[model samples]
Target chain A: MIRGWLSSRTDLPLKGDAASRFLPWVVAVMVYLAVLALAGALLARDSVLRWSRSLTGTLTVQIAVPAGERNLDVAMADRIDRTLELLRRTPGIDRAQALSADQISALLEPWLGGGAIVDELPLPALIDVALVPGARVDLKALAERLAAAVPGAALDDHGKWLKDLIRLALAAQAAAGLILLLVTGCAVAAVVFAVRTSLAIHRDVVEILHLVGARDRYIASQFQRHALALSLKGGLSGWLLALITLGGAAWALLSLDAALMPRPSLAWLEWLLILLPPFAATGIAVLTARLAVHNVLGRMI
Target chain B: MSYAGGPEIVSDLTFQLAAGSFHFLTGPSGAGKSSLLKILYLALRPSRGIVELFGRDVRTLGRADLPALRRRIGVVFQDFRLIPHLSALDNVALPLRIAGAKEAQVREHVSELLRWVGLGEQMNALPATLSGGQQQRISIARAVIGRPALLLADEPTGNVDDAIAVRLLYLFEELNKMGTTVLIASHNESLVQRFPHARLHLEGGRLERRTA
Candidate 1:
């Protein structure tokens, strides 16, 4: 039954009209932009979530040496050791380990480059702290305790950085959502214009249909079917193009250092989400055409 | 009665077409034959008069109610208003398809009707490819294929020869005998005189009923 309905012949020569010829292309472009925007939102959200999850239950400690000191002196080394010991004894902290000189050098290699220059710079001692799962540590109290136990010691939970990252991700997703909404609006407007033009061009055929016992819905269905077919054609093409573009972008990003660039990856669910724009475009086109036809036909006697 | 605030093309016209009866609506070019037929088929509502169909006043009928009522009526226009894109078979199948008849039944019935109208081989031919008279026959075939309770034809035989015209009238009569009410509007007085059915002659927008 569905097949038959889809293949039903249209009484109006809608396919031959100029508007119908271009409608699919318009839909394709709209769906393409929509898919990109939606993908951007999904990727941003996913990346932020992964980053945040990795950051949870983890803290960092930084021990600053005196300004005039060129390296981690005995006094700074003692402060770093005391900070790590204090964190290890804290109720919520599971482990605390101080970073070696080589580890800190490796962490700075991407920005500071290699060699003695990074070694000669006045560097601070660092400790990586892990908290127990579901741990609620009073970070301010811990910082104060460490400061009292060892001067120039500070506890860093990375809260400010994570909060800023989350805010940026949310803003990106919101922009993508807004873009998707605008694309949808443009698609609907295109469909309405095309349908109205087709109606005007085929007024006589429509009148003939009406006189021969065809209802408004019957006539509107003809337009709807045409719009659906066109939109699907355009949407699929747009989606395919978007996938290729995304694939190309991912390929380009693959050469970048993984540590520098967040990998552009989509889970199975995200891929499925990317597939919705084409179907969504077709739905919008079909509905817009149907409503336009009905509105115009309603005014007819 | 009027169009776009212009003078009334047809006014004060009151007539009833009895079920199972056939009538000829005769008038000159400007006598509003087409306008009256348009009103009958629910294409145009009279500006200020009660128009009823199938025993219901058209004025009281909402837009949603018209299609069912329209399905019970069929119309053939003076211009042979066949859909240019559709084949003769598809064009004739339109009314049945619109009414949601099964495709198998629609094809069978529409094919038989096309054959009866002498266009069996032209079933797949588009309206643009058919001659004027052939298109007229297709138009007639489309209108009566549904076995509508009322059929309105405006100059249905205008493009055809006398023999085909007579044959088309016989088809309308056949439907009329089967309880279909038919109204054929034409300026062909000789053809009207040949028919035994009553006539509704329109002159200057007024109507005069003539008994058979």
Candidate 2:
């Protein structure tokens, strides 16, 4: 059975049918594009959420007391020293530091610009913490403790920015998934139609086989093998071409001025999603050919 | 061969040609002579007749079981039905190849038969390149290549001159003498008269035996 179907493919001029060849190319390209779109949603959104949440991983402390404000400056500095001491004793604290005046301004320089204002603009003291790698810090408990030691102290976890970023990333990924489904459906329909057209054109061959008493399976197997080969070839080639195009787009995105605009870095693990298109194409093509062949044979005989 | 269409083309036809027997079907055009020959060769079903060949009913045979029967009974159409794409040799070898006989064995048998039919010099020539007599000879070679149990020829000599037609009939007679049942359907009165054989006559889809 396998041999006869194979011989039919090689002996018959099925590839001579233009639709047979062209359809695979279309399926390959569409699937590749769909995969890249899906990958874009996965990698970009994941990176965005990760970067946004990384911005605030520490707590700060300060003291407010009655006296001349400059006299209380010593007390505030003393309170900051105690807070850092206490944070070091905490279980998950990797390291914590109270930022000096200049260190605080350097952090705001890109946003505020250089040497544009006189001294003494009121700014909250900031503490930078480098968490233990792969560790989770308790922000609520740390905030309460810092408020008690330094009455004016407050903890910043960068929650609002992270929440919005995660939401937007999730929404984009959802949209990409919807597009992939639509493209896959379209590819299946195209391949099915192509197979049907080729079968119709080769009606005489089918008639000859019919009169000669060839089983339906014997006829359908010929189309199945041909359709599968063309589809996979087109699919793999299209994926390579789509990746080349996508890599160029990624390069363009990366070349933007980082000081003016920040974008998520393209990561390796998430590109795994890029493979969906070719596999989808192979499945659709085989299914489409099988169904198309059976349908045509039914109508023809 | 039993067909169930509204009108009968061949009715109550019952006869058999023993192995090595040769028969001639003679009647005017449209007298169902071709129709009767068609049934004999498994081409058309008889409206109301039992055609038992090789101990099996033609009408009861499934399509899957028909090819071997067809291969055993070589059919030469009145128009010389040769596949135009194939060379004369290939056309003759089609039956052997389709039956999955050993390739080497088929080549030997086809080449020898093609030589016997005087197409040895026309081996490489396609059907379209052959003269009518040459093409008809190739058709005969194809029919007899398998050494079929039964051979059916319709107007086997109609398209050729007397000399070529005589040569073709001699080939049929040789095959018949070698143990192949032969049935030749011809409207040519002189040709049938020249080649002596048992005659089966049909008129208005009815058969009559002429003992003489």
Candidate 3:
């Protein structure tokens, strides 16, 4: 009984929607931008985390054979086998696999062009290494051992390159965050303007309500409800637009499959994050409308 | 009561009506009859006087407390301030809605009051479609819908015919007899003279009381 009475008590007429058509579209655009930025940030951060985790305990050993050797093929084969044997004997090294000539040529195909020149070039013999989880490898000591066994042998732990990659990803994520903040601010400003205009249009209604003993909260709640509805409408539209755009991009990326950039994919948790922008936009609209109404009512009798 | 840095609109106003009493406020233009009524209904805060309404000092009342106090009183503006977008029934149900009354009770009471004010057929009509007299009755029905403890009307019968005016006065008398204090500010002294109620005469922002 009480709930029914309270719910039916005060409902402002939804007529006289002076800015309804324009305000929701503006909010939709803002939310779209916000969702895109949030998605970008989430994807960038996730990619960085996955890349770091996969690359954390790995090394690549490269042994170069001199270009003008008397028997370069035999010398290269001997150095590659010796390096593999040494890596297998090492304590922290879990697995080591030496790259075949064809494999090396394939790796360079994208960069140096796939032709006979890639075979003729005296490219260094590459050995892929994997370290046991939680096992610390002394790369300097390992490098010395490999160098003693074979001249021109180099061990790369990839720590410096990994640091730079992670840094770049973090910077991109931060830029996306800044964009999200800007979009949220724009949404708030739009809501405030819409609310202020609505209040101005309904100024006489407010005065009559006040004269009839309506409390400030009662009056403000009407504006809040209206603003919330607009925000929800706009927010959902923007979210759907964002989802369509993302789906299209993912499809395009799948079709292109490792052509240039990395294939785009989002984890389940990351996909859930796409829902935040609309709800946040709605919340911002409600709060902004309430504050705006309270500010105007404060100045009135 | 006055605006800041301006001359007092109403001053030396020192009279109290007994509960359930009815009084007519008579004054010429610019005499501040409406101003006094505004203060009485808590619409305007007086600059340099204590206002006691319903046995509480309104001077020290907080903003949060104003709505509750206001719910106990009702005001009919000189201009019928019915919401133009709302129907007559909705306008009349406004106070009950504001008080958070049950919808069924609000509908029943507002419907009954609108009928009593001779607006049964026009209950669903917007204020803009109604004649000025109909709007005036709508405003009056809104004011008395909640059965307020005090009722204030400013030139309420200004737009109505003499017969309707008499009927409206009888309605006010009935509400007064039911224990609601009534104060009406008007320039219609002849019409007011037809009733046997006390009168508060204002001249140049000063007040004089004349009792029956």
The most accurate candidate by lDDT is 1
Model 1 stretches with alpha carbons more than 4 Å out = A1-5, A68-72
Q: Which portions of model 3 miss their true places by more than 4 Å?
A: A1-15, A112-117
List model 1 lDDT by residue over B139-202, tens digit each: 9998999999999999998999999999998899999999999999988878878889999999
Indicate whether candidate 2 or candidate 3 has the larger lDDT. 3
Docking class of 2: incorrect
Expressed as tens digits, the lDDT of each residue in A45-90 for candidate 1 is 8888898898898888888776655564777776777777788889
Candidate with better DockQ, 2 vs 3: 3
DockQ of 3: 0.74
What fraction of the true interface contacts does model 3 reproduce? Answer: 0.71
Worst 10 residues of 2 chain A by lDDT: A3-12
Best by DockQ: 1
lDDT (tens digit, per residue) of candidate 3 on A166-202: 8888888889888888888888888788778877877
B1-212: candidate 3 lDDT, tens digit per residue: 77886988887689998899999999898899888888988878989878899999998888888899999898888899888888999999999998999989999999998888899999999999999999999999999999999999999999999999999999999999999999999898789899999999999767889986
Candidate number with the higher lDDT (1 or 2)? 1
Cα lDDT computed for each candidate against the true fold:
0.88, 0.73, 0.86
Encode model 2's per-residue lDDT on A152-202: one tens digit a residue. 767666677677877877888888887788888788888887888887777
Model 1's DockQ? 0.76
